[model samples]
Target: MLPKCIGNLSTTLTAFSSGGNRVFGEIPEEIGNFVNLEVLFMNLNQLSGVIPSNLGNLRNLARLDLSDNNMGGTIPSSLGNLTKLIGLSLSGNNFRGQIPSQLSNCRSLDSLDLSSNNLGGAIPPQLIGLSSFAIILDLSRNHLTGVLPKEVGNLRALTALDISDNLLVGEVPSSLGACIGLTSLRMGGNFFHGSIPQSIRLLGGIEELDISRNNLSGQIPEFLAVLHSLKILNLSYNKFEGMLPREGVFKNVTSTFIIGNNELCGGLPEFHLPDCISKSSKSKKINIVILSTCIIFGVLGVAVILAFIYLCWLKKKVNKPVPSLINSSCPNISYGELLKATDSFSSTNLIGVGSCGSVYKGILKDSGIAVAVKVFHLVHHGALKSFTVECEALKTIKHRNLLKILTVCSSIDYQGNDFKAIVYEFMDNGSLERWLHPSATSSHGNELPKKLNFIRRISIAIGVASALDYLHHQCHFPILHCDLKPSNILLDAKMVVHLGDFGLAKFLLGSSHDTVANQMSSMGLRGSVGYAPPEYAMGCEVSREGDVYSYGILLLEMFTGLSPTDNRFGDNLTLHSFVAAALPERVLEVTDRIPLLARASVWESLVPMKCLKNG
Candidate 1:
């Protein structure tokens, strides 16, 4: 609730901010009297009701942010009156109806965000395609539909543009390539079709690009590999085909994602795809026609004999039993060794418990090396299968940030009962869950502190991102850790992250990112409550997007020191919404006190105050 008395300061006040508070109620129309105000921020609050049209009266306002509120109704066309405005953010709200085309009048504006709202209808070409945006222009996660106008090329100074997760249709315009300054471009999760525009080759400085989960078809462009500045690329779940180029970004398997394109073949050996048939091979086969008739007949006779021999070999293979594990290279450890290491599964050694099993801390008898032994409860419905799936996932992928499997044991115990366990290098720092909520979950004698500082949290996040990037792109078969939570994130003595727990992991079959090899066998909810994406609860199949959603929640929890299942969260309010309500301005208030105590001025220093004032 802003006080109406503040209006009296309209002539003297240069800036006013009431963001990231629990303030509610409509903004008083008297606020429009602030003719001298240069900056106004009321974001991340509970404010309801329509925006006051009178706000446009602030001709001097250079920066305005009223995002992440409950404000609804059409955006006032009066906003176009702020011809001097440079930045405007009205995202994550209930605002509905078409965007006002009159906004194009803000000729000086360089940054704008209208994402994550109910705003629909065709994008106003005049407002977007004609703007001389220099920083960022994000209109994603809305219901907006229609073709992206070619006039968008006018924003040649823009560095980032995102229109993903919308209903946008039609081919991407070639004119978009004219925005050569763009470093990040995302147009995924749309209805876009046809080939990627050839003009994109002009965007030599582009770093990150995502156009996945669309109707896009055609061979992936070779120019993408030549874009040396390109670091992250996602072209999955489309209709791309033909040989994948082996140069530049394509050679770095971890940075590129291209699954769900069945016709694609021939890249690095890591992709495990069939060799591409060259034109020379076809010419050689046709040359056989020039051979003598007797030679052709002799070739047909040899083929028949080889076919019979192949049939006999196939018959022998059919009778052979299939091996349970895909990887047999792992050293086998017996039940006796595990019993000696874990002290006969002593309760004193138990460190953690999960859906499929319990983890025990142990030291190998011979090497005296510390390890964490995960012993599955075979009595549990899916425990045996979970063990097998984990083993296969671990053996197939190797990454620095991923937990390393030391050995595995699969044999009968003294009671003649089945025993299965996996050994991993012990993480001395323990799970991220313990550190984030130390008071609630930390074990006695745990030496780690309750709060992680700013630099530490960022490092952990980067480590986790690297591990996920490898699993989703670099692996021969993309793996989805259906369950990603703070508990699954471990840290070593050096505080480096190690992502563990693959009990519910799913392997994408063939080249389809959405089709799992054993989906039916692992049916039901795909992840832990609170962390799982909403679609999983609706019976949707597992997807890479789902893992990303869980990761987002985990990241929020890490910095906020609040769990997704925190008692404070309710039906409408979530960890996501709570954070959304206090971004940029109230960020420090919602942040875990640990980081702020270490350094309070970090975030404030990052704000581009010069741009806000000069523009």
Candidate 2:
């Protein structure tokens, strides 16, 4: 139970968060006394009882989240008094009654989530039509009824919208297509009728769209097949008909779902859909004479083709050099070419060194394209295995925030020794480690000092998180980075982050198989010493959590400018604990001085840590 005395800080508190805790019992009504509170988060708790109506008294509140709790009772209309509120989430609760139309008065609101609740009644047009909703507006898994208001077009800035699994009826509003910022839209599990609106083509950037289990009919839209960004599309259990397009996402059955739509046909062979045939063609009867002639000709054509193929194979075997399996997936770059590109492995071209290899700046002679060449030292114990693992991992995964392999080189060097290398696009800004802690002996001594502002640091963090999310959840099979640290994070010209260095990558084959493989692979440490998780040291099986632990340490290091293995962290005191003990009050003491050099006061320096703490 929350202690009532906790509200005594109302006189000075500006923010309060107790989310994801085991706390229970009713919230203290005295919480309304925090006139200066700007943010309140108590989500993912066991709190119950009605929201204290007096909460509306906190007129300065800018964000309020009490979601994923056992809280019940109607949403109090008094909440309308918080005109400055920017986000309000009451989702995953037992709250009953209609969504208070008064919530529309929060003109600054950008995100409103009332999903997974017992709320019923028509979705208030005033609330749904709020143009201030720029981030998301989720009312899914509720008892909402009536058509989505046409005024939804007013929210042209909204990025995601979900009204799935509701009592909604009528056509999907064409006005929704006007919100061109949408990346995900789900209106499935409802009674929505009619064809997909033509205006939907305007949302060219939509990535995940689900309109399944509805009454929508007509040919599956050709526009969907042309949506290059479309990844996960669910059109199942609808009345869609006609030939499914063979282009774009339709060609990948694993990412697109069309099951239960009986009339749909002519998709990928993996879909096992019936061949689409015109009515006239289906009704025509073939003559026996023509059929026999076609059979004879087809056999003759097959025999001729086989003979030609065999002759071509024999000639090629004698005339051309066969490509290696590694070269088959990548461009056919010879070891000699890589050697020339790196100026015969000159010391001047060396940019970074790794456990198994050295990365050199190089330029392809023919194309004049700048590249980063990672040439493995084959003599190193695990260098061969590292090169193989990196190639296997890179070939299967591709994402904007993850590094891209341009080609691979596998052949004999001038000495007739095995040579292995991986080439990647050159990053102008270089690795995160160089910026976070510049070396006094850096080759570029004439260059000015480098620093990352608060915003840039946050952007880098988000990019790294996105890359990890893709590897862990969005791949054909789960992949674990195993190694995530500052040195592995690269920055491009625009300062966009790209996660690289996958030599320690591991594919999770499934639960039991993964455990056995992990144990076998645990013969050595999975990642660098300080960044690896403690459980890994005990021979625990590799899991996604291991990556997250490394990411957490990376975050602390990013803001504090202190490595996990920094000498200051000794005895029982670690970097994480050192920072944790100085937060909210002594935030500036532990934070890197670079971000604070331009700040005016202690309050200004707290911005970054405040956001991290609240989240």
| TM per candidate | 0.49, 0.47
User: Which ten-residue region of model 1 has the weakest summed lDDT?
Assistant: 512-521
lDDT of 2: 0.83
Summed backbone clashes in each candidate are 1, 0
- Largest lDDT belongs to which candidate? 1
For candidate 1, the per-residue lDDT at 493 reads 93
Pairs in steric clash, model 2: none
lDDT against the true structure, per candidate, is: 0.84, 0.83
lDDT of 1 by residue, 1-615 (tens): 887886777486789899999999999988898888899999999999999999989999999999988887779999999999999999877676689999899998999999876566789889887657999999876656788988899899989999886667799999989899999999976779899999999998999999986779999899999999999998987889889999988988899988778789899989776788899997887776656556788888999999999989888889654433212344578889888988988998998999889999987786777789999986675565567567657755789999988888766789987678999989998999988998778567755556688878989999999999999998866899989998999999999999999878988865432221252233357789999999888888888999999999989998888999999999999999999999877887898887875554565466666654463
- Model 1 RMSD in Å is 22.4
Which regions of candidate 2 are displaced past 4 Å? 1-330, 511-523, 597-615
